[model samples]
Target: MLNSNMLRKLDMQDLMVFVAVYEQSSVTEVSEALCVSQSTVSYCLKKLRTSFENELFVNTRSGMLPTSKATAMYPHILSILKIINTCHSGIPAFDPTQKEITFNVCAPEYFELLILPKLVKRFIGSRFPVIINITKFHRDIPADELMEGRFDLVICFGPNFHRGVKGLRSQVLLEDELVCVVDKNFTLAEEAFSLETFVACQHVFPTPWTSDTNMIDGWLARQGYNRQIVARANSYVAALNMIAGTDFILTLPRRIQALTCDENTFSHRRPPAGLPNFTLDMMWSEKPSQDSANSWFREQIIKVCAEDGLL
Candidate 1:
């Protein structure tokens, strides 16, 4: 049995390592799960042995087997640890006005233009330090980077694969509808956009990392018609700029159209009919975060969305 001194001397983190290795039957597996080095796991195991007065595990032909003494200690030890962990599940509040922590936000260009600016002003006025990394939204994800805490939060399209990292938190950001855009001075042959106009007009299709250009191609394939692509880009901003000067048309989200059209600047701007809508989501690795700070930031985002009629 592990006495009070044994428990006191053994850090809970080391015990967790020991428990994970015990259950997994391998140090390599536990090291990967905990995102730590194999040497660190081995070191923790040695400490556990010294505290427990026995080899907690013995390598057998089948697997690393936990000793009888170690088996006896599992139940009460795991229960107490679980209770301690449950108490920490709550996400904390963050008062940006006073904090000086650097937060990293990952997103596609759309969020950078439509979402980041407003959030940055709030951050600066509140004195919170931050950095934004703009990467193509369609790149193959690096799952280990997420486990290693590369990004504080991701502003992305719905669906992510890195949910096993223990502290993941996700929220649906908003449902954005698509719109048709053209230069204010440009004129279509018809006053109202029709299916025939959509099919015949020279089109500017933007490729944002996910092979969306290909998806769009597929969507239009069955129709026996497709847009003539005059230009393409992985960035939405580029597409927006190109559409501002030509007779060609581009599809954009309503929020973007809302920001881009200042009746004075784009008097003829309008979204065409028959495009689909999609949702954007906000996600974070929630586990290692300080609880109060998490709660505060998340609520602020939600509050801002509601105030702006963005939800």
Candidate 2:
């Protein structure tokens, strides 16, 4: 337990260093990120350790690893910094045109193909001078990552966004159903695309994004049906190549198929009936203090989606 005197010794700079070192796990990197000298960062870390009575971090072969105490203190320290940042800058009205700003967004390749082009065009036309940093979406949106200010917005599939995460909000941007792409010469055995024909065809599954155990397989399992996946490709381009002149079927999102497939080489058909549609969502953390910048940025994304007929 820190007393008043110990608390007084700890300043905002010390807290910032503590958080940075914990995140980056390197004093030099923390110094560079904070725009302070290594000695200054060391001094701040020393003060933090003295105040908290914990080493907080331990140097190891891999990197500077946070100690148990440091891990426990991380969330609370991050919350304090967020509150201070909100108090310091929350009152100022955010005008995107007036100043340069950067927003970090996390999304999958699907967003890059469908939404990012229009979003960038809108910003370029408006001359907002804002930088948009895009990172790849992972399996799940961790609450702490958003709360830590790492990502300003996250666009993901409905199943990828967990609703149980507190302090986070989400809105559905668009909905899309799956479509089956096959070589132009490929023929459906039945009059219409039936489940029997669908399962009989050799499938080329996209790796990392979907697999035999994905929603398609899950749905098939419910109906006591399964498809034969003969190959896996890391990308749609590779999958298309694999499907060229071959009777391999690739099931993917309708929007993605429109973007990746060539009409001359491939044709897309409606997937079998009872296939589930997935929603694309934009999620963000709700801070104790709200900023209009986030609101403005979110509206821009929504506007792009609506104009693209994706909404």
Question: For each candidate, what is the lDDT?
Answer: 0.67, 0.83
Worst 10 residues of 2 by lDDT: 206-215
- Which digits, one per residue and each the tens of the lDDT, describe model 2 over residues 1-311? 64647778888999999889988989888988999999999899889888888888888977789989999999999999998988798667668799899988888778878888888888899898899898776656756777888888888778562446878888999999899898898866442367877888899987534222467887888989988889888776788899999888898888899888889998877778888898888888888227688888898899999888888
Task: Please write out the lDDT profile of model 1 over residues 190-256, one tens digit for every residue.
Answer: 5546666776777777665564434345446656667788888666667767777678787767787
lDDT of 2 at 262: 89
* C-alpha lDDT (0 to 100) for residue 6 of candidate 1: 68
How well does candidate 1 match the true structure, expressed as C-alpha RMSD? 13.3
